[model samples]
Target: MNWRMTRYTYWMVLAVLSFGPEAAGATWHVDDSNTSAPWTGADWDNPFQYLQDALDAATAGDTIKVAQGTYHPDDATQNHTEGDRSETFLMQSGVVIQGGYIGYDNESPPPDTRDWELY
Candidate 1:
């Protein structure tokens, strides 16, 4: 392999090994169905109503699990104009945001199932 490619691979492996589950932080949840739910985002049943809420609460090494739903950028922020395209979801380094979850099925205990092909 080329020198640059070898070095890149080495660094990638090292990074993965160095930052393992020990570096992992909390896992936040966001479900659109939980509009009136608490802002905790602690679990599937009590998830943040908006994706923006999870983003705001997340720190480095944190993971945000989002349920299947249509989320608009303008829905969270009221300061910006209704149709303003400038408003966007700013991502953070080391913070993983994942979607495709079937959250809170109204069972005794909510279920957190992730199947992207469910649609």
Candidate 2:
């Protein structure tokens, strides 16, 4: 192949790699205090009320940011059908669920700041 063609191919590969699915992961928010129903879980203000909701929507390479609160699988609205006590949160491969985030507050917009000790 010509040097120019080889260089063009390398740039094309780099562009694809930079914008691939693995490089374009999504971030989902989960907050127990969210009174708003039918939230998209796309941002902190309008977050998924249930942890399971975010989990259900998350795919590979996605990140689920959960607020600091108690979340039980039995209270799941999406994953658990019968609200069985034996139900549990299923951890997906390549998906990171990070907790200790201060979710929506009536006073101010929730911060992206995360501190496990001081939520």
Candidate 3:
């Protein structure tokens, strides 16, 4: 309504647009190691490499497209520890992961300890 309020709203809008979908911080990409032009490249073209990279750089609302490979955590722990857990792959507050999502149990090598969550 007022010029001040309008200006604040404008700035807020700009911020949201620039940073993106609020908690949008997920990264998507294949995690295979065999889809490169040279083939000799170090997973350069392999979706797996890119996928892993994205996961590493993801924040929130991001989605990682895992091709077809084993996704094992470093610790193999059964805990999300949301909020600020490094290896948790929280996918932020509003992130989504695509591809290779075999659910909580399918994620691991069966007999899962119940660690991942699929929203």
Could you give candidate 3's per-residue lDDT for residues 21-73 as a string of tens digits?
Answer: 55434344544443443322122232343333455555566665455445544
Candidate 3 weakest lDDT stretch, 10 residues: 37-46
Ranking by lDDT: 2, 1, 3
Best by TM-score: 2
Tens-place lDDT per residue, model 2, 55-100, is: 8889998999988788887666654765577888776788899998
Error of 3 at 95 (Å): 1.6
Candidate 2 residues lying further than 4 Å off, grouped into runs, are 1-22, 79-83, 106-109
- Candidate 1 ranges with C-alpha deviation above 4 Å: 1-23, 77-83, 108-110
TM-score, every prediction: 0.70, 0.75, 0.35
Task: Judging by lDDT against the true structure, name the best candidate.
Answer: 2
CA displacement after TM-score superposition, residue 62 of candidate 1 (Å): 0.4
Candidate 3 deviant stretches above 4 angstroms: 1-27, 34-53, 75-91, 101-119
